[model samples]
Target: MGEPVRSLPHLVGRRLSRVVVLIAVILSGLLLGAGIEAQEADNSTANLPTDAESAVAARVQERLGTAEFTPAIVVFDRGGDALTDEDRDVVQRKLSELQELAAPGQQVFPVLAEDGQAAFVGVPISAETPEEELAEPVAALRDAAAEGLPEGLRAQVTGGPAFIVDLSQVFDGADVRLLAVTASVVALLLLLTYRSPWLWLVPLSVVGVADQVAVQVVAAATQVFGFSTDGASVGITSVLVFGAGTNYALLLIARYREELRLVEDRYDAMRRAVDRAAPAILASSGTVVLALLCLGLADNPTSRNIGFGGALGIATAVGYALLVLPAAMTCFGRGLFWPFVPRVGDADPTRSGLWARVGHAVTARPVVVAVAGTLVILVCAGPALGVKVGLSETEQFRAEPEAVTGQLVLAEHFPAGSSQPTTVIVATEDRDRVESGVARVQGVQRVESAGEGEGSAVLSVVLDAEPASADAFAVIEEIRAVAAQQSPGALVGGPDAEALDASDAAARDQLLIIPLILVVVTLVLLVLLRSVVAAAILVLTVVATYGASLGASWVAFRTFFDFPALDLSVPLLGFLFLVALGVDYNIFLITRAKEEAEEHETKEAIATALAVTGGVITSAGVLLAAVFTVLGVLPLITLTQIGVIVGFGVLLDTLLVRSVLVPALVTLLGRRFWWPGRLSHDGRHDGRHDGRQGSPAGHVAD
Candidate 1:
């Protein structure tokens, strides 16, 4: 019997070793497969949902032939002076040079502003030109404009093709910068949390691998599901994978450190930690995934793509955190904890630490804490009601790009919509009526017949208002109303009309998707917590946090950033991120509390759970906020606003709502908090299981 028992230890070690190797092989295979598939992935507008604007675009494409073309406007200004004959001759020569350089199927036309202080040459890109090939023609035009300009004259390119070129340049390597910043932030946080030189690299490396895999997976989704993807969606995927994966890593590692003090063998310690942490991680991830998946029901293709990509990222984060991280850490053994390694039989430091004191204070005056928290959140949320949605093209960028500069110069000397004319497609026979109706619209500066087909004709209506401004959208509505009376089948489309349609689609999506997301997330929390009351409380807390964040962000945007208006997509996207990620922290806290309640009375359990999970949750929250803040560095207003709103919201959830308000409510409703659950029926008297015997005095916890 002694001989067999002595061999048992070797047998267990061998089995554990085999398990680790198997996990590594599986992860490696997955990485290899993802890498290969990613090379063939497509990210383009070809997959955009057939919304109203898309239908208009399709009709326009059919009329114009298969080649997609965008106009490049080259604006030339001679300060505020009228053009002399010499200036006109110089500009005409430059325009002729530009026209000569135009590609096949392209056309260049020169128009002098009525004031004659500025003139622009409009160069149409060839329909045969691919998206990647647009820069060549735009570059040629710029180079042509650069040479031989007269004194006091300046020239720059703007308009659709030029804007695309500039935008592409701005986003070039943005993913790399975001990844670098996120990795650095997460690495520093992990190092501080563990105070170990080597421990941070393990989870960081795993998350990096997981991030790459997630990108490929999202790319795969775009190809397989016919969903559209843009630079914004791709950037968001990286942030989610890194931020969420690191968050799960922090929670699991923190719990593993605690379990190490209770279990002698590293393998057993890991098993116990994973078994205990998996539920909270899964519940949190599931809530986020379900909430994001609701975006698929959105009318906007961008929202659908973000929903699918974000959901996939959360799922991947959870998988690697629960599977790969644990396997890798277990293989590394006790040395992973380094200098402050936990020893078996050591007492948990959290039991007498800051959160324990905080828990006491919160429980002592639950009503005061709850009311104060509620009021603070409500005050912050009040500003959200005043939020205005819709950003003009000029407002989309934080700093003025060349395109915006050119547009401004053009606006100074010409009709605001001269560069981008609203196109009306009507029956050939009704063209005269449609053109007359469009000419009579309030903002219409001029109307011209642009092209004609077998049974249809295209009319270009130039407006006096900025093409992408609110006034322009209103004018489009009038034009549409007029067209309906004159030409029943007329299709109105242009840069301004497209913007209006997009804004309307976003508004519809918000109304349709918000309630759907709320329902889905609430159902998920109810199932995960197994208590309707607890789930409802969590939902309410997250909603309040979202509103507060949006309100605060709106103030920041107006006062600090000098933004004129919010991006059309910001509100819905911000809501999705805040509510989903906010619930993540709640799930972490409440799940731990539920676990503790099994062994202690409700009050003591709340105290113990808060004490044990406080540091890790706070660290995770800070890391996530920092990661999101990196989005601001990209120079896009939509991304910057989202970063601010979501980052601020996560901090709010961590420090106030999850820490104080939630615990206070749980304390005040002791046993009743978990109504209809076994814990409610099995609960011991409050404050009795632990050493405390009566109501404690209120005091702030760290």
Candidate 2:
């Protein structure tokens, strides 16, 4: 069947060769994955377009020869009670020590809030500090703030620099944690799917090794490419390797088990299984890789890097699954299945079960089933219309870190936007004019000259609203507009302005990349399934699945998680993952159904296809969903939101859309479902029970 494709699995068929490949794969994974530890773990970017105003504002300072320094806010609070004189004395005593932590060209200054209950020390740390060494200065400041502190007064090191440190810290041991959790989840699911204890180990170990190897590859790629990657991307990549890699394993092993029933020789069975299933596996991986690579067109640096890293990981996973995994499986004997071992004459257990009945039920009333499934998807998607986009800076964390709390405290006790003020850079000659214009703006509370260097001057404008709020963003827009009118080259930036630009960039990227990804995926489906009708149907179903999953997840986020708004990247990233991964089940099911159609009527073929592929796809889907859910282990809100959305999307796609709706559509379409393909008019069919009465005989669940 795979004559055009060389049986790469069998190349390692020699007893010694199989063992050699297996051992080599494991060692490579270990040594290479360990190398990731040497690569820096912090790769996060603001995820904004480089040409945006905020980005230009950031660069203006560098060009003006002023060192880039980010402030670390040292916040001290006395709860509802006003700060006592003793509390003020302690802050005074620590001010000199905190100044020691500031960057060489910067200094620290203590300022008491008007409310007298909170005070802050703004400590500037050089932005040029290497990512690995960023925490050292922040840590020293935090230690100084904590020791010899008087009772009833507490302090937290926060603001931009501290936020960066905390965010990176959240991923300190995330790889090991995610790997351990993902591996354990995979092992458990595999063991359950194949009742034999020994059977589960084969695919788990193979996929596990692939995930570790992917980590090393991703880390190395980051160094060579110098693209912005972060701990969250690293975590997501590992999850993808385990989830998608193990899925390939499940599909392969299921076919292998089925083939074992007809082919007595275990080695021969493995070869036949690889020959039949490899194409679908390859097609599935191709679509995902291509779709992920489309992220290269994204404006967000993190999005582009994620696409690159995820694509590399998927390629690595598929390579190992098709090559190393097959060799590893063949090294074992039939006894690997233990009491459930397949015999040449034994009944294929997958022909009947929850899936067989579902097939029967679907065939009985294709129109009704199709209508009902569409309604479910539509209902799930309703809430999406009201979904909000763009979480505030402090909202980026699921669990409030000291930075977030400090920002809140600062907001409560000080003037509006006291925690962080918007920065504006302009030509030194026009600084006074631009500053005067900005000061007269409706939202401007005050404008202070930061410094001047070369031919440029910097202004820190305190706005009349909390940082990153809608009001603050509005103020930034007004400030920018005024700057453009009074001083054309003035650049406005800082936390609030950067976030504003990021939101706009995310919107722009969505418009550009979404259609591009859809086109890529659609073209891939068109190639994989030769029938235009089938390809169109699969693409529509995947779209519906994405919409439904996003809508449903938005509801969950609001109702249970109480999230204010989705991160700017969530909707686009969620759509990308759902579309790419959702097509996997379509490829698996429809390809199998196509094969069955050669020998059976259309309705009967689809029913039979469902019974056979149901168990494996369902198992794989649930396992993948669970692995994604493990992202909840990290504290970042963006990652958590992604995990929930994608996880739920996978479940919805696997359990409903693939299992019922698509099959029903095909059943109703009859032979026309395969129109333009040989199966529509040619090939063999027994014409037994044309899908109205008896469904295909057999249970397909594992």
Candidate 3:
């Protein structure tokens, strides 16, 4: 009687404190959103590493006052026939109008191709200028080219400046689209999972706000760190927050709902839910955050920034879900659940669970389940053998942009690399020899001096193949070797050389980052599970899931979508996401199994874990997979490939690997699964279990 009397005030105080914390979290979020302005991430910083030869040449050119030049090529053609007299007049007229739109020193004129079928002018724009400043003049040129065109003769803008504008144009409004699609998908899934209008709103509202806050946080981080970022990386990060954050919410809410049935007081129920959910949430989020931070080691500026952005975004999501979400949920009390409010002594939701049946089937035949899963993974891996890498500049877009069309047209009428030639920089004394040597290289159409600086000169070398092509990349290498032999300090730098260097950098990043990611994930799993056997199995299954996703996505890309080659960034980015995120579902599953194992036999605990967790984990998995699919809307091949690969990988983890393989392994291994852990030694441990408690059998229904 004295104890009850004493605890009453403490209970009331605890509830009041929760309300205060809830209000603070909400107020803090609003302040964060309103206080910080979103600065667009800077992606124009060179994509290449500073130490790359192309980057070196760029520095020399900057010193020579020529680094700012980004030529916009204006192509005029009359289709199959040579340029007519009227077409030539229209070209000359347009060039005259374009001259007024150019920067102060830019010269605007057209030189006819040797075939007399087309003509182009390389109008200079400063690459160093802000995108907004560059866009104004470029828009004027495009607008001017569109009007006053002779009926048959059409003008199209292609080249470095035009393509850069095209890239920016497609990415316009991408974030809003991704947010809408992701929100819609999550909302629909929540409705289906909860079967209540009001309950869906809680997690959705919480996750929605978290996503916006994360974006702002990432934007702030980008400004603070000065890391390179693009629309694609930012969009991808937002998707991750919504997907992973909602997943965390689902896991917590499911546990909370399960607890609500066992307790009458909403606060006590929530306390139990948080106590159980927080460890698994922390472990999984920590693994993802740590793995993402490893991307800071990547050479590509975009990958590195994603590392920072993803980490910040996940941290924001986890903070809000674990802290703010619980408070908001309890504040609503049982009323928020509507018709399905969980009552004290209510029927266990999992009594008729579908996942329990799956467990039964698996436990009855673990060997068959294991063998079949392995065979499926192996079969899916076949298409990966034919996977290609490298997409040329024009091929970067999903739906061809105007610039790609114009570039293709330019290739038809002029030297393939005429519009965007490679620039070789060398000392003035070495320029002649470098040019002679470069011109003599196979596939080199032309090489000539462009400009001279204090001690350096620039040579524009046109290739027979389109820039960013295998043929053109080879030519770049040959030119570099020849130029270096002729002049020791000669350097090759241009769009083609930059692409070559970017590809090589991605390869090196893969070699170093992949191994580190594996080790990091392994260590996290080992520490969390306290079992080498469990950690190794989880890591191996995740690796298999990654390989299977790649193989499957590559086949689909080739057979259905007709993608020529996977982008160089695709493999590492896919691996980074697939392996790290692939383990997320497993962490949720095995952690629950371990908790159940403390009170039951190993096989029964796994089955019970599967039954209780199956619904929420599946919902989380599907939601995550769908949110990543939102990347397809961006129309960048790289982003789409990422979406497809990660999307498939997550489904594999959720549906096949985590759902089927990991469980069977655990059931078969039994006590050995927890080997060396204290649980393994005793086969039991102390936990809170009361006569009034609900059983794992309660979860089979959900």
Candidate 4:
């Protein structure tokens, strides 16, 4: 019997060697195919939901017999001095040169600042301009300004077009940086976790392939699904694949190492390890995938892309971790562990480690521990209710870029919204009435007939408030109300209007998608745990953690970061990640508890499970948190906010919720924690079970 058992691994390893080589070939082909088909990611707001602003923009374009145009503002400053005749002449010549470069039927206009220290040239470029095509026109305007500008005068290009060009440049090579940082973080963490230099390379290599494969898969899926890809989606996909894939690898490898000490053959140990780890990994991935898929119901285009793309990436990570990783590790045999290889009959270190002490303490006073944990999370959750959503365009950047600086200068000298006027498109017949109504709006500083179309006219209404400000949003809303009364089909569209619409869409998405995600996640947990009570506890705990994280982040954003308000998409995306990822730790803990309960009493099972899984789960959580924290390296405020919130939330879930709170709650609940399941009403109902079932017997401190 012993000889056959020992030989089983060799036989299986020999059979799998061919399969591993085939998988390697397939992965290489996938990588090559992906590289050949790679295309530039689109981050345009043209895919925003067909809200009022979008509909209005379309109508204006149709009426004018031209496509929508993005406004570019060139601000010329004379260093707080009144412009001289020479400066004015130079500016006028540059303005003319800029106008000459405009598309047919498009016009450029110049306005002097109230203080006479600055002036702006507004040039409208066709909105249909491809991203790569934008740099040329913008550069021409800049070059024209530089050609003959007076010594004291300085010109900067800003506004919608300039912002787009600059933002695209910021993200140009961001993928490489994000990948480098994420890979380094994961590799270092894995090295520390495994305590072996060589073991970390195997999982890291497999995960690298997984990350590449995920990108191609998600890109293809988005194209087929008719959803657009953005820089955020592409960037986050790498982070998710590496962070989550490595996590799954850690859990599997830890189990494989444990099985190695029990089983004589390396192949048999890995097979048993895969069997033990796959379920938890699958359950955790399922929760995240299902939750992210709920983003499809969102009204925001970016959210939708993230939802579908992130889900696909996670699914890909699971596949590689479970299938490719296991095969690769088995192919390497026992040598993969190197200096720390586990031998048969060796004791599990987890039997009495830091986790054992944690389990013992929590089991001693379950109620006290549970109550204290709940209170701590609740305290952190206090600020979330008052979180304000929506950041001004300038606030979107962690460090102010040239465009933002130009906007600030323009805002200080001119009507704040002059750089990007609120556009009201109305039928030519009602143009006069609609124009009068818009001009009469409370915040309208000035109104002009910027252009005319076949049967409609474009009314550019400059507001007293900054273009992306909340006051400007309110003013646009009022203008829309007035337009509806005077010109029934009039469309209100511009920078401020677009921002307003995005905020509304984000709010709607939060309301719609949040509930859907929670319901989906709850149902998934229920099915995976096979216990309604356990699933409910897990969901509630994660939700609590999410609230705590958001609330804490709100304080951090306002107090430390000095951000005026949260980005429109932050709350929705943050919730999606926190809930989905936070629940993962719970899944890791409870699944092990269920398995342990098959042999021991409920309380003893909880303690033993905690001692066994505490280290791996904590390491996984810390590793995921660290990878996400790398997002802060980017200069985008949205990414920074996401990194801080998700990183902090993961730590909270891992240390407080999973390590202490969950074990205490399960201990307090006893057999009832698994209500309606066979384990809940078995012979071990009274915490008196002692014998092992179906596996090797081991001691678990009570």
RMSD of each: 5.3, 3.7, 4.3, 3.6
Q: Deviation in angstroms for 401 in model 4?
A: 1.7
lDDT string for model 1 (1-702, tens) is 000001012211336655854766577577657654332212223123465853565467566653255578998886678877887788788867887866665678899988878888888776456566777878888888978877777889998777777777767898788888888988998899889999999999889888887887777776787765667787888899999999999998997898789878887777666766777787788888988899889877778878888899889888878877877787777888888889999989888888888988998889999999999999999999999988877777888888889998888888988887788887889999888878988999999987777677888888999867889989999999898788887788777887788788888999999998889888877777678888788898899999999999899999999988888778898999888888888888887777666556777778788998888999999999988888888998888998999999999999999999999999988888887665666424234454433222110000
**How many clashing residue pairs, candidate 2?**
8
lDDT of 3 by residue, 181-299 (tens): 98999999999989998899989988888888887777677668777467877887898899999999999899888888988888877766776777778888988999999989999
Q: State in Å the error of residue 520, model 2.
A: 1.4
| lDDT top scorer | 2
What value of lDDT does candidate 2 attain over all alpha carbons?
Answer: 0.83
Question: Residue 293 in model 4: shift from native, Å?
Answer: 0.8
Which residues of candidate 2, in runs, are more than 4 Å off?
1-9, 12-23, 26-44, 682-702
What is the clash count for each candidate, in the order shown? 1, 8, 6, 0
Query: For residues 516-542, what per-residue lDDT tens digits would candidate 4 score against the true structure?
Result: 988988888878767788989888999
For model 1, state the Cα shift of residue 119 in Å: 1.0
Q: What is the TM-score of each candidate against the true structure?
A: 0.92, 0.94, 0.93, 0.93
Model 1's lDDT to the true fold? 0.80
Off by over 4 Å in 4: 1-12, 34-42, 51-53, 59-63, 66-69, 78-86, 96-100, 104-107, 147-152, 682-702
Q: Candidate 1: TM-score?
A: 0.92
Q: Is candidate 1 or candidate 2 better by lDDT?
A: 2
